[model samples]
Target chain A: MSLFHWLRKKLLFLTRANLFIAIGFMLLLAGWQVLSFYTHEILLASPAQAACALWGIIGTSYFNENFLITLWRLFFGIVSGGLIGFVLGTAAGLNEDIKNILEPFRWIMLSIPPVVVVVLAMLWFGMGSKMVAFITSVLVAPIVYVNTVKGIEMVDEKLVEMARLYKFGFVMRIKDVYTPAIIGPLGAAMVLITCMGARVVILAELMGANDGIGYALGVTRSNLDVPQLFAWVLVTLGIVSVFEFILLRPVEKHFIRWKL
Target chain B: MSPVISFENVVKEYGGRKVISGLSFQIHSREVVGLLGQSGMGKTTILKIIAGLEMPSDGDIKVIAERVGYVFQEPRLLPWRTALENVMLPMIALGMNKKQAGEKANHFLGEMELSEFTHYYPSQLSGGMMQRVSLARAFATEPEVLLLDEPFSALDLQMKDAILSMIEERLLVQPMTVLYVSHSQEEVMRISNRIFMMSSGSKLDELPIQHCRAFRAGCKKAFLKWTKQIGSN
Candidate 1:
């Protein structure tokens, strides 16, 4: 295709909303690099040191296993929590009795601090990947549930009436009405669950995990390996972003084409 | 012959209020019946009950067929879908292939004089145009009974007249059992074969349009006399 056509297609995808996200990230990166210059060299590694050191340590054996472990934990945790929460959320939305039963639990989940799930999981499930995964799942469930339920509540009642009048079956109703409305928040929830899952994995490692990025960050902190610690943080965050772009973005784009 | 649709001893209650109590009506085959009523007198509710959108609370309702196309009080087009796509939604909902559905929808749009606006979204259309698109969608499905709830009540006089003329021409060639709900007396005389005037939960009068037109204000012997008679009934 010609460059003109390519540019036009690119422009079609352009929106102020997503463009602002890119701009904000760039600004934050720049500010962090500039701030490093005025700070203590040991405490705050210069951007050059952080970048170079991070690159050098990218494939190092010390960081590789832990990072991979945390990644796996996050993926599984998010999937489990998101599925359960989605089911619960939809059921509660459809049935008043379910809503009455689950509303209190949902509120409790929302109000409690993140650490509470983490602490409780550690205590009950015992320390390891399993425990960390459990904590992450618990942390993510409510956010996904609440957003999905809210999306369901916003479906057009009149459209539903039209569906009934036509004798549209369950599959047809879902495809025509519910899918368009539900997918929006459901897509957002997936993104959130993924990020939150990563956080919980790291936090769980710090709390009790023997292997994962969190454990490495924890070890490096105690040993005053600030540069290495910063590198690990950067690498983990990079991994998260890469997965979101590669995996989640395409899925979100497919489902959210209606909004466009 | 049994009526095409019948509402027998219909008692419609909404949260302890008796909206339509012990009401009964019958519409025969190929007849266009106008439901003339004030707002919130349960005309839309009756349409819904017949459409099976809502089941009656206490009534014996008989609909001859399952195919019902409903035009809601408002045009409820999918904002995300184009005119053709919105019209094709019923076909798609019925499990028709997208390719076939689109072809059928395009045909209907052309028939409705909306071929140029097939790709336009509902938000882009004027209120009258939206109603036309909604009408096209309902008719596209080839429904057995087309239930219209004040479909053209939002249009300006010129636009409304043009639409009604189109409807009249179309009905001459291809007629469905139509239950057109409206408050406009002119619309009833123009389109309806039969008229049922709803008043305070009972029919003020149910008569042929040929007779009812004379009883209306403009051409009547005495407008005040007819209005007083209607008011007392």
Candidate 2:
């Protein structure tokens, strides 16, 4: 691999595709914003004004407060849900007796909608971080659990036997065999849960919380602050994409190079 | 030489269809034993039983070796790891420190002439290279007994020749005992010191290499004289 070839590989790997898409996105928003001009700009903010408001929102203390609240809830919910899902999923996947016992419950979790879980859970526990986290964790758990169970069930039995012959201990078995095996579906499942978890937290905030991006959006809406609402929406989108690109994508690549 | 592994009256079945019935063998040290049978005759299952992946229905199995290394019919290398990492898998499992495991893996990969491809993943390697990595992984364990399940059935002629000889050199140069399973009589003759013929339902006829080395004995008249006699009866 020469320097030129290396550079070319890097260039191809990280393309201008996202930036161009963003440009096209700005064009679409510009069109939508300009259309608002003819309608007296009642509900929609112009793209330029919205961009200015995006900067304003980021520069203000309100953004920091709301971002922190949403971030904390999502993180807590996902970690808790992922751990529980992993444990229960592995047990169900590996043990026939355990699967028999847990099959009905796991199926029930998979079938129930997150919105329903949130509404009922909010009524039961009240609208707060704990309630939201609990609901989001339930939402995340089934996806993780189902994906994990599906992953383990598809684990190449021949490799398991190979591991046995080598006498692979618990740690080595996970690192050497199971990690790569689980990472594919788990990667997809994590992304799904993260998206759902974030949305659930925002909904939890909108329902009753005093602070969060969702609450800020609600405040801006009632005040007819269209620009600020758009800014808040952009912030949420930024957090979602940034975490996706920065955190999950590379981790997925590291664990599942075959995917690349 | 004392017997280090034994299978007595082993019975194997799948959904009431008996595959190996009353199978028995005593494998001693310092021998490369070939298990030969036609497809679906359960040669692989016998190796699977000895490797402890599957248990016999009603039999006694005694293995005195500290570790048993196996090369599955499939490559079965961890797709995430390099060929070197895959080869050092057993050592890592046995809790050897990273330095020792890596050094051992590097040396064996070098011995197998796979130094250039040490960092390659299973997908990156050719079918032959993948099989060699599997072989290297099995041998790098330093186990007393190696169980191979048709390790070279997938390779082309050139790759097969190179890999089989590479494996032969590694095993022959060390105190490695192998219970190799293969469907090809040619493969059996090239590597095995003893051969076991398995027919339907666990009946075995063990033949020494000197007696059954068809080409070497120039029994061109009856290439598999020993195996045929039993099958015909």
Candidate 3:
């Protein structure tokens, strides 16, 4: 096909979802610009100012050190929490006694405030990355656990019977039946956890740690550098988007691509 | 002929309620048996017990087959797998590698007239098409015994007729002991070598059917009369 014709065909297949997403982003930027106009430069940085400040930090050693530290903490927190929650959730879902036993603990974990956990973790683990990682994992575990249990409960018994009749081994049964059964609910939970994990890690760092993005945000705040603060916020959001879109979304789609 | 499937004094109960009590029957080698029953008459329970999906509360159940293929009331297909992949599942579980299983799955899907829909997922297919995929999955295993529990209820007239003929053709090519459970008298009468009606108290009473491939109008009328008589009681 000619270049123009080929491009037209490809664009024809583009769904309205991307267009709507672009519109949403445009609206956000417009709102940010309007808000910045009404506030002092020291209070609210315009998008352009924030972009320029972000450009300034792009290759700085301070930015690299803090960004990598925060990224590692976020990574470790989510992985550890997700793994622990999946194992416990599967146990609780499969056995009534286990579910009953875990009920009060689940309630406590879900209901306890993030601030209280951060304070308690600070007391227990002291400051720095350890405290931040602990707080992130503590806040994230209940979300994944609850969703996993719900997903397991919703699994179709007919499909399980079919698997048994076909003599599916343990690994095949989990791969074919359980994993797909849980992926839908778990996908939504992962997105929630990703966004929440980013916020919690930054918050914990702000509260108890002397390093990472939250500490840098605190530094910019003390210096009255609103552009730098906004830049840090943008970088945090960017990190969340990268993990959500690049890592979690593709894995979830691979598992449940049969869905329309 | 030696019985391939024999259940002696089989009893099953769920939560203090008895579903099957002292049910005894024998299905000989290559004999296609049709089980007719109302909803919740333990017809499915009987099939489950034979397939080893459920245990009899009290009895000896023996199935000579090394493998058993089942088609449930619903398609019960893995929603994430395509039509071809769903059919390939049992063959792969039975130790056939991917390539061989894919070829066999293709052959069965072709037999069900689902060649074009091999890559279509369950959600993408219609109700009848999904059921056809389930049928293809069952037949692809080439099991020595096949259990079909109201598998055709979800299918329309044309699809049901085509599938019934496909089952008949498969039986002709390679005889396997089949227990076809359904509420449709015509369906049971069409394919069954021996027909059994679920009577009161979880018991089965053999009902004679006209042994003809064409299934004339008179035989259908007689079968309907018998069904009504049994149904009313």
Candidate 4:
């Protein structure tokens, strides 16, 4: 294909909703610029000032070190939680007795406040990244577990019956029938858990940790560095958006290509 | 020769509703037996019972065959699997190695005239094509007994004829006992050695097709008369 035509095709794939999102973000920047003009510089910095501050820290060792630490904690917590949740949820789906046993625990995990969990982790682990990781997993695992269980429950019963009649063993049935049925919902849950995990990790760090993005934010708050804080927040949002749209969306599309 | 399947006074009930009551029949080896019944007359239940997918509430049922192939009313191809994979499914499940199963599946798909569409997914195929793929899947296992539950009920006349011809050709090469279920008398009469008519809460009646084959015009007249009677009731 010609380069211009290829570019046009790619642009066409961007829906009107994406255009609206871009417009909305521009409006937010305009609003921020207006607020910064009205307010004291120390209280609310202008978007331009924040952008300059962001550039200053973009490649610095301080920013990179904190960002990498936070990223690592987020990844570890989500991966560990997602694995445990998927295994347990799938088991519950296959066996009614196991579902009954796990029902109360899932409910308890979902209902408990994340702040309380963080506090408990802090008390147990003595204020470190370990506690932050524990807090994030505790906060995110229940969402994954609940969604996975629901996904498995919603699988087509007729397909299961067909599998059984064809003498499909458990593994074959899972790979051929059950996995496809659940993958869509699990993909959706993974997206939710990743975003939620990032937020929870930052919150835990802000509360107690000495390192990472949350700690950096804590230091900026004490220093009354409004531009730096805004810069850090924007960077975090950019990372999450990249992870969600560029990475997870493509992976989800791959998993559900059969549907297309 | 022993019967391939026998149901001795089998009874099946669902939530106090008797779907099949005191049903007794024997399908002899290598015979194509058409089971004729109206909608919701428990014909499918009988097939399921024979396939061991459902158990009889009472009495004895015996299927002497080691392997049975079932073609459902709707083609139940796994949407995620391609036509070739769907055809290979049962053979692989029955412990055939992947290579042999692939060759067997390919041969059956060829017979069903689905060789060109082997890589297509179920969603990509037309209804007739999907049903043909389903037939290929059923025959790929090389079953001793084939149970067809209105397999052509959803197809148009031309598609139906094409499928019936394909099935007829397959049966000619390798004879197997078959229990063909359908609502049309003419369809059953065209293919079956014997026809069994079923009604709710009534004993099944068996009609041999040997004399009917000798007198084709007379058999058509009788089929029309029987259909009219059924319609009036």
Q: Interface Cα RMSD per model, in Å? A: 2.2, 1.4, 0.8, 1.0
Q: What tens digits encode model 1's per-residue C-alpha lDDT throughout A73-126?
A: 988888888877888988877678998899999999889887888888889988
Worst 10 residues of 4 chain A by lDDT: A13-22
- Identify the candidate with maximal TM-score: 4
lDDT of 2 by residue, B130-223 (tens): 8888888888888889988888888788887887788788876776779888887777778888888877666877775556666555564455
Q: What are the per-residue Cα lDDT tens digits for candidate 3 across B7-75?
A: 888889999889988888899999999998888889999999889999988888899999898989999
**TM-scores, all models, native as reference:** 0.85, 0.90, 0.89, 0.92
What docking tier does model 2 reach? medium
Query: Candidate 2: where is the Cα deviation over 4 Å?
Result: A1-27, A34-40, A113-116, A119-127, B208-210, B217-219
Pairs in steric clash, model 4: none
Best candidate, lDDT = 3
Model 1 reaches an interface RMSD of: 2.2
Model 2 pairs in collision: none
Task: Show how many residue pairs clash in every candidate, following the order shown.
Answer: 0, 0, 0, 0
Per-residue alpha-carbon lDDT of candidate 3 for residues A57-99, written as tens digits (9 for 90 to 100): 9889999998999999999999988878887887887788999
Question: Candidate 3: which pairs clash?
Answer: none
The lDDT for every candidate, in the order shown, is 0.81, 0.82, 0.89, 0.86
Ranking by lDDT: 3, 4, 2, 1
In order, the first chain's TM-score in every candidate is 0.87, 0.85, 0.93, 0.91
User: What lDDT tens digits, residue by residue, belong to model 1 across residues B1-233?
Assistant: 87889988888888989887877889988889988778988898888888886677787999996578888768888776789988888887777889998998998788778889999878788987888888788877888788888888777899889878877876777788999999887887678878877876645367544466665536655433554567687
